[model samples]
Each structure stands twice: as structure tokens, then as C-alpha cells.
Target: MLSLPATLTQDHARECLEQLTDGLQAEAAQVVVDAAELRQFDSSALAVLLALRRECARAGKHFAVQGLPQRLRDLATLYGIEGLLPAA
Candidate 1:
């Protein structure tokens, strides 16, 4: 399981993505991201997740997220991309 940072904004998007991507390489067929610690964040957080989801797909792995905050879920719904981030 991979964990998200407490704060994930546009400023940290790139670095966070790199770190998560590296972590993904060591995961099994199922990739579960724990987002409960995420507090301060922006849409970039979703961007990172989406990128990670794509990366998982490319690697033929299953992807899911856990502990997604309601606000973030709302954001994803508003963007009409909630389906991309499956819950664990």
C-alpha cells in the first residue's frame, strides 16, 4: 500500500508523483493508495492519482484508492472522473 502526503498541492505534484511512481514498482498486482492523511490539497492531487492510475494500467496492475476524503471525492465527481479512482 502506498500512502499520500498530508499536503499535496500543485507545488508538490511532480515530486509526489515521482515518489509514488517509484513506490508502485515494488507493489503487487493490486495497487492500493491510502489517501486518508491528505489534508491540504488541490486538484493537483487528483491529477497525481490519475497519472498513477494510468501508470498502473500501463504496468498491467489493478489500481484502487482508500480513505479518500469526501471533498476530494466531490472534486472528482465535479470533474466527472470519479470512476477513474476506484475505492479499495
Candidate 2:
């Protein structure tokens, strides 16, 4: 599982994304992104997940999110990206 840090703001998007990518590249099972700690996020934070999903697809791997906060769920829907972060 991709455990998110205490926060997921724009300040750490790149660094966190890199760490996530590293974990993805080394994992044998499906990449499960854990977002339980992502309390508040903006467009940049959203981009990080989108980019990771793209990278996973490019490398032919399964990707799904875990513990997504309601704020994020609403953001995805508001931005027309709910399809990317389906329930569960």
C-alpha cells in the first residue's frame, strides 16, 4: 500500500510522487495508494495522483486508491475526475 504522509499539499507533491513511484516500481502486487492522511488538497495534489495513474498504466500495472477523504472525493467529482477515483 502507498501510505501517504501526514499531509499532501503542493509543497510535497513532487517528493511524495517520487517516493510513490519508487514504491510502485518495486511492488509485486497491485499499487494501492493510501490517502487516509490527505486532509486538504488542491489541484496540484490531484495532479500527483493523475500522473501516478498514468505512469502505472504506461508500465502495465493495476492502480487503485485507498482511504480517500471526502474532500478529495468531492474534488474529483467537481473537477470531472471522479472516474479516476472510483469508490473503494
Candidate 3:
């Protein structure tokens, strides 16, 4: 598992997505995403999580959001993917 630093939103999201996709293929299991430290986020950033889940499913590996912040939860709820992440 790796924690993504949210400072560089787009880059962080993309890098995390790539790592998840690549790691899942080799690991053959879900890679836990630690979003506890995330301070800020946006649509594109959240989409990476969605894309990761999809990619992991397509690759036959599970993926989950771990230690998500409440702020993120509300945003995800607004985006309709709230259930996808761990509760704050």
C-alpha cells in the first residue's frame, strides 16, 4: 500500500492510478489506497480512484479506498461514488 500526497492533484492522481493498475496486475490482489492524508481533491483526482477500481476489476484484482477523510467522503457522495470508499 502507498499513500498518495494530494498536493499535486493531477500528477498524484495519475501516478497513483498507474501504480495501482500496474501493481494490481502483478500482485493479483487489491492494492489498498490510503487517502487519509488527503487535504484537497477535485473531479479529475476522484476519477483516478474510479478508474483504478475499474482497471483493477478488468485486471482481476480488487481495489479499495482505505482511511479516507470525511471531506472526501462528502465530495464522493456528491459525485455518487461515496460507497466506493471507506467511511470516515
- Best candidate (score: lDDT): 1
Off by over 4 Å in 2: none
Cα lDDT tens digits for candidate 1, 14-45: 99999999999999999999999999999999
TM-score of each: 0.99, 0.89, 0.74
- Score candidate 3 by TM-score against the native: 0.74
Total clashes in model 2, counting residue pairs 3 or more apart in sequence or in different chains: 0
Instruction: Evaluate all candidate structures by whole-model CA lDDT and list the values in order.
Output: 0.99, 0.81, 0.69
> Where is model 2 poorest over a 10-residue stretch in terms of lDDT?
25-34
- Per-residue alpha-carbon lDDT of model 2 for 1-88, expressed as tens digits? 7777767788889998999888888865477888888776776777888888888888888788888888878888899997886443
User: Which ten residues in a row are the worst by lDDT in model 3?
Assistant: 2-11
1 or 3, which is superior by lDDT? Answer: 1
**Which candidate leads in TM-score?**
1
Question: Which candidate do you rate higher for TM-score, 1 or 2?
Answer: 1
lDDT of 3 by residue, 1-85 (tens): 7565655276576776777567565553756777877777766667877787787677776677777777767778898888775
Ranking by lDDT: 1, 2, 3
Model 3 Cα shift for residue 80 (angstroms): 1.3
